[model samples]
Target: MSADTQHSSQFALLRQRRFAPFFWTQFLGAGNDNLFKFAFTVLVTYQLQVSWLPGEMAGLVIGALFILPFLLFSATSGQLADKHDKATLIRGLKLLEVAVMVLAAWGFHAQQVPLLLACIFLMGLQSAVFGPVKYAYLPQHLNERELTGGNGMVEMGTFVAILLGNVAGGLLIAIPEVGARWVAWSCIGLALLGWLASLKVPASPSTDPALVINWNPVSETWRNLKLASESKSVFRSILGISWMWFVGAVFLSQFPAFAKDVLHGDEQVASLLLVVFSVGIATGSLLCETLSRRHVEIGLVPVGAIGMSVFAVDLYFASRGLGGGAAYTLAGFVERAAHWRVMIDLALLAFSAGIYSVPMYALIQLRSPASHRARIIAANNILNALFMIASAVLGGALLQLGLTIPQVFLAVGLLNVVVGFYIFLLVPEYLLRFVALIASRCIYRFKVRGDEHIPVQGAAILVANHVSFVDAILLMAASPRPIVFIMDHRIFRIPVLGWLFKLAKAIPIASQKDDPATYERAFAEAERVLRDGDLLCIFPEGAITRDGTLQEFKGGIMKILEQQPVPVVPVALQNLWGSFFSRIEQGTAMVRPFRRGLFSRVGLVAGAAVAPENVSPAGLRERVEQLLAA
Candidate 1:
């Protein structure tokens, strides 16, 4: 694509009505969050006297104000999101922000630091409730192809907001004569504007209107948590998101002290560090779309985690050069901007965080059950709250125990290495490409063609000849984007293979007799996927070929085609007649040995896409068969 065409395509996404409002709402929310928190932190850290409350105590108080809401209100917020129109819910939340900002203004005017803390906590509560609606609503609004781009945009916006907020908060604090009060009022105005913007958001139907509302925070939170935990992928995603927050919270919380004690810089320099970090996050988020080539791209998570660790460790060394002395004023810090290493560390830390988070969010949205998505999101919020709190406490405790802020950075960075290794080891499916490449090198070699026929950037339906059970895995390896395979529900439940499929987010379909509802739901999900611009691969023969011959095509493929006019790519898999995962012995307990050595040809042929107008199920089947024959 030419530069202008590419620019138009990118800009086209922003023009979308379904996406724009939610994008703005989230952007404004993230921006306001940082604005208030950074402002509050600056107040307590620089403006308030130590005699009123120790600096450490003030920081702890600020931390508590931010996290306490998740513990108190996340469950209720999730339940509410499921029981109402999400657009209305979001509007209501934005209005709540207006009220909270009023209190903030009062706190600023009266110089009541404690009251401002209360308002900060209230904002957190609002955000905790907003979290479920924010995530759950995406699948409803965006097509699958749009999801990645949409997510990338939202992440990019959020980081930009954080950067803006951090800059504004610091600048406002330095203003004279009711400057802090004016900042609070400006925040309130922004909140109102956000509310007005949210009102323009189209209605989002409730996924589960009949979901029982639970008022008991403890029990309800635990129930939602348990429900999400039941799905291993969802549970793991929660852990991954939590780990991100833990890592981020540690870095963000210590930045001020690191600037003051280690870099001997003033509040402006501290805020500059935040700006650099946010810039990194924005860069990384935008990079995710390009890196994944527009898929969920779980593979990037490990890569991101590694970058975070390396940069954070380097930051420790970078901080060691600062001589112990009294803190410099804002002007003094600017003169010391020659330290390029500090800039590098800040940028890398932020960039890696963006890379780590964006994919995980996409995975959760793609994998979670549509009906219970809000609850799952609520569960994620709970875990994030818990993790961030733990991060603050642990980092603070370590600092108290004589670990310098720089050392803490190094420690977290090193620990991230261990954590990343463990998660990948635990879930190798996320690292399937690496394994597939190694397998290709040692065992059966494979060839992929007509890949250009597959939509480079939109949803498609792939019809392939299923030669063996490993066909989906092979297809996934060959295709540029992730494929949501339509599999026999039975195979979807296979011990080891089942785990892998679920991780890959395959949609399982059952025979009518076995479970009619599940079968219908699978088709519905397939339709949803196509509508969202995702690729759904199905074996028209309905099951693996028993005698290495194509079975009669099923009507399910027709049903999918009828629902969406997206391109249908025909694929042919060959030469896997005898492999360990293939069924060489029908109805027998025996299996073939693992194939080894290169030059064992495995051909994956992709034919030109069959237009929806010119093709029926039979036509698609015939085309695929011909491709396979060639």
Candidate 2:
């Protein structure tokens, strides 16, 4: 097969039985939701008038009703996911959606406000319960390498559905000729299609069959949240995801008003705004999958958050001095090229959101235990709902305090900066990932071959031929798992490099001739780390080579093998020697200045892992030589 076809095959899951059905099922459900919500909203705003609940308050009321189910039912929903078959439960939810749409159809035809509100609440309940199941199902099916791409696809599908659903809703309801009849039937048809699709999704067996179902909403919600907080990284990740939701809720709420009051455009303009945002996000999500080399790189979250703030602030300024009055038609809105900057800002904001969100979902799946993974996902849903509601309340409070719409956008942007920095600080792994990601993107076009050799989940010792100072960094960049390197103790004392070494969790060893205790300590730590099912990388050569050549493999690797009989993966670093970090002396300097320019291409070859019985210092070195030859 061609390389193009081979690369694109990473998304083979989307075409497979395991993933495709679930994808379409959720896609149709999301689209149907927006169809019903917007159809009824337009019905109230344009055709009907009630004293108790004014048309102006429809958006808030609908938003509240939808979010309420997530807050109330998610705790119980988590228990259901962990204790029963996910496919069956998901199918049941789709059937419930069909029933809800039946009610929605009647409400739309009869123009009954109470029945319509009930349908909204029921739709929210379906979404709330499915949230945990939707996210938790990915990790159970896909391999670790496929998780990032799978998530990117799912995220892209969801936003595309949203964009299409809103457009369909607007077209069906707002057009006087077609009106409510078309929208009502469309929603019902969509729901039924979702149910049919759900039937094809493969069964996902429960992890905790004996888990007692938690029935109390209030206390069970707290218990589920506490379970999520058990791991610091997991908890912080939940916070990060929730914060992004809050930011998104704020922006999604403002688009209609922003289009009419700020951009002076009608329904078409609002749809256009959503279109740009959704397309940008979809593009960004796929871009993240490509950039990370299909790894769950948490560093992109920080990148996304920073980009969100920058674009949002720019959006506020772009709207400055632009006068708002009579609504602009679609043709007129597109005529002025200057108005495009505002669209650009909106697109970039959503683009950043795509980057920020995909990795976070993958992280939650990767880190959370399979036994309670669904419950953890449930906790995330609850937090997202609360944060979204808080976003609404906060925006209201700020606007009441005399802030303009553009000013509110500015405030949300600033808050993103503060929230992002706090989360990064809370988890330094994300910060290290930031450094690793930037280094790979800017300093070098780091490439890895034979990454499939790295085991997805197991204890493995990586035996690598280290060519330069940044060998570990380059290897870590290519690896899907966090690798702990065993390095010389003196390297851990090199000022800033030492600080970074500790952050990367490198194991520092000393020569027995110099410090026997440190040398023994390194072996003990290696044993412990491997026992915990983590990857450990060691340079088989005792020292960095003075020339661009391989050295004899040392005996220390045998010592690690003796302590723990984990598999050994031989790795080779290609094109890194003679670089600045390598011990290639130039003139009077040990390391030359700018010998190799920025973004230099380098290769890392991960050879297949050898069983512990076949591993030897010389055998591993020969394996490294064979990989280098390839």
Candidate 3:
């Protein structure tokens, strides 16, 4: 294992030449984008009350202008990223930012509304162009093992930059006489710093150098969507991420009103709420590497969705009863013990949103074809913009219908429950991974060694000793890739586990003596799985062990291997003999819950794959035995 894959080692990426420069460049760009926009919004809202740009309309117009470019230019931007070196594109984009900032400075000095609006649109264009390159660049540089941690770092940095930028803009634009002037200077400086960082970003060569650019966004956007939709998982991930943005936009756009009306707090308290949210998301982003165990673990998605809904619902209840009262200062808000629950709810909800998003992003990066990765990401951006816009519309409609802000929160939280279930059911892989995660993290203190022996791609047959009912689940958690287990049909009737196995599409086999047709079909299906270059796992012992000993390997595995000739990997489940899932007392399993206590030690050790011709049932058994003993 590389040191960079360890917990907290994601921070070490900041010191690496390949990652640091790109990180800072993107970081500054995000910060500058928010800084410029917020300052302008503040200018229009507080400093100058133009009839065309009322305070109520300032944020809306600025936001619309900013996101408009994404809708118009994302497809073209994606093509550019695929067709040219990303480092070169990044440097050029930074230069554009510098020019935009220079113009913004002039607009601020002269108080030119049209010019400032143009600047917002121009900044948005720059961001649209950079989005595809930003995601596409990471996969080119980082290996699969580093993808999750790297994505976590970027996600964390982007949110942190956004928070800092908003804070800086609000602070500088509030200065007595020189606020706008200071904002202009800061924007320009940040642009220059981003350009400087881009200068050091190593070359990320084009994935498709011969690709033709399509300047028409209308046709290209549709084409991009179709291209992404070709891969169901990748497309669904894009949709899932877009939905997250939808939820986030709803909550974020409401913070000001939620704090002012519901919590009865001043501007300072609203800012405090934003601070908590940003920090919570950043904390959750950094935690992904550890929770995912250095892989693109989609299991965390469901877990995150649960936290998001629970906290959002609780937040509604936490602030529902607070009536109109004296506006509290930041410190005053904190002084009230009743308000702490609101803060906690907001923090945990934001944190859950963070956990929910990073994995989907990573999955998209990993699964999308390399040649069109940027275009798919562009499709994702277009979807995100649309979703966020829909969020604005939805929030407005709900509030217009006389629902209080807290009620809106309640609506979104409940809606999330529906959306989360719909998406997870559509993609059963995510649901199965969640089940595996629960098995490994909650039921057992699970550890896996030699997981690298499991093939990252192509065909492989995994033969393991079945010590307990949950052995396949623990094995699933251990391997990065999904496994199609050939399990006894009898286990398919064990209630919840059976349903999950069916969802996972595990093939069920019966003893040939009792059911010849089912037995033959199982082997044929297992063979077909290997032929299709997917992982197939078989518990050769056939059933959960009645005693704490390795049962003799069965010939069913040999029958499948004889036809498929795929590499067979040996795996052993250790320290599970006395577990609740194991038949340890009176030949019954799961009779005494917590027999080994929660998170009791358990391990999965995978040995190197044995060649097809050299493999035998006895040989595989000995290999698993060696692994268990080791």
Candidate 4:
């Protein structure tokens, strides 16, 4: 591809007119939400110091207020998103933000507690209504390949906004010259800015304009949840996502208190903690785009979960030595013993959170059915609200039961490990992708070539030279599709490794001369897999190389193609001959124990597919040899 025609960067979308406006519009909106909320929190906790609700319980109440609208209105909002043009919805939402800010400004001027709480709930409502419109608009604008990058940018923006807004709210309210007025007016102006940005966002057509609106929150929410639950994987992913919210809510809601009671730090120090955490999240989120090669890689989900759990556990240890009533400023907090460890723990925890979240959102976008996608997102929002609320209730319960903040952190971290293990066990593909991601990125140095020759969609026969036992896993790591490999039945009995292949659903092919029934049954299974529109990979060599030389292609390729008539793609693996799986010593390949040093260079080359009618045994061998040579 020419430089002019190729995409420059995943972030290059931000420079384009199609995506830039909406990005800024939403960015400003998220910033405004946090700014207003925190400014109010500062007013209540620091200045007013209300006695009616103790400081410890105040965060729970405010957080519950903020997310309440999500539980109540997510379903109706989803219907609106589907029933109206997204750009129009964005414009309307921005206008609503303006009106809400006016109310917020009025409440701030009067120092009315009821009105401020109402404003917080209004902000939550704004966020809830925008949820479906926020995500569903992406697929409408970008191609499938762009979705991961686009979501990454969105996550980066949200976390950055959260950081900036919290910083602004935390700082501005403390300044006597600025106080609530400056905060309120700044929010008003930001809302107007968001509205202007929304005006420039191009129209994104609704997915289901003809659908009737469901006003009943109870039944509609249930219906949306049911829609999301129809797909088992997506549903489990939704649960995973909600659990993320739960973990997040507990951690974030405690920072203000944690900074005071545990770290002996002031409000500025708490704000700095949030700032550090948000920065970590933004960094990890952007890194996910690069790490996954801009795909919805479920593997990163487990990796992220692992990091989050480990760091969260460490956070408890880091914060254990807080001597209460010391009164440390931000700089003093840093000067204290082991305090730097706390910041590192918070940063890594949020960083892993960013890595964990982006891929899951992309997975949802790719997995969801288009017609009901908005409702699915709405269901996700509802569940998110529920989980967050539960976090508050459950966390308050834990605190009441005499658990310290560190103990709570320890418990949550351990719980994360359990949940992550459970999810990965239920879906091994995530674990496989994690393995593949590690292999490609860190283990063997792989250089893939001629990947463009492989068709992006539809059934095809992938005939590769099986130079190493690791060939199938390596190819799967490289290819976007899930490939079902045809392996020798004996190899499938190799204890642990064999069990993994069986779990991967690799077809066990036997040599017809030795076992006719098994051979015939394998062919029948291959046909069934292809007919189901899945990718099928076969080693036409019928065995790995005894020596590092190209073997003559067996006739199985022709036989399968005759039965299935799928396009045949020829692939070659080079420079893997001396690997432990290869027959480097020639005798007893499995027992010989031979391998290239770590980080050995390896290459995989693919050739254009040959039509089923055009492919012959000799021609296919020539193609494979040509690829290997190239």
Evaluated with TM-score, which candidate comes out highest?
A: 3
Candidate 4: pairs in clash: none
Worst 10 residues of 3 by lDDT: 1-10
lDDT (Cα) of model 1: 0.79
C-alpha lDDT values of all predictions: 0.79, 0.85, 0.88, 0.85
Better of 2 and 4 by TM-score: 4
Q: Write the per-residue lDDT of candidate 3 for residues 1-630, one digit (tens) a residue.
A: 454344337788898888999999999999999888877876776578698866544665677778778888999999999999999999999999999999999998888999999999999999999999999999998877788899999999998988888778877887879988999999999999999999999999999999988888999999999999998889999989999988887776666657667888765676677788888998899899899888889999999999999999999899866667788978889998889999999899989998999999999998888999999999999998888778778877887789988898889999999999999999999999999998899878898888878887789999999888888888889887789999999989999999989999999999999999999999889888998888999988878878788888888877887798989999989999988888876888888886667889999889989999999889998999999998
- lDDT per residue (tens digit) for residues 185-258 in model 1: 87887788788789878899988888889899999999989988876666886888889888888887766667
Better of 2 and 3 by TM-score: 3
Report the C-alpha lDDT of model 2 over 1-630, residue by residue, as the tens digit: 344433554467677888999999999998898778766765665467877665545555677778889999999999899888999999999999999898888888887899999989999999999998999888888766678888898888888988888778866887785578798899999999999999999999998999998698999999999999998888899999999989987877666667767788877777788789888898888777787888888878889999999999999999887776677988889887868999999999999999999998898899889999999999999999999888878876776687877899999999899999999888877877877888778888788899878876789999889787778777778777678899988878777667888888788998998999999999999999999898999998977777778899999988888889999999998888777778765422225557898888888899888999988888888999998888
Ranking by TM-score: 3, 4, 2, 1
lDDT of 4 by residue, 1-630 (tens): 344323356788888877899899999999999899877876777677677867777777789899999999999998998888989999999999999999999888778888889999999999999999999888787755577788889999998999999999888888885588888898999999999999999998878989999899999999999999887668888888999999998988888878878887888998999999999999988887777765567678888899999999999998886677667888888886688899999999999998898888888877787787888999999999999999999889999999988888899999999998898777677777777777766668888877656664578888899887778878877676568889999888777668778768898988989999999999999999889777899998888888788888888877787789999899999888877667766444556442566777888999988999999888989999988889
Ranking by lDDT: 3, 4, 2, 1
Tell me, by lDDT, which candidate is best. Answer: 3
Candidate 1 at residue 326, lDDT? 79
Lowest-scoring 10 consecutive residues by lDDT in candidate 2? 1-10
lDDT of 4 at 539: 90
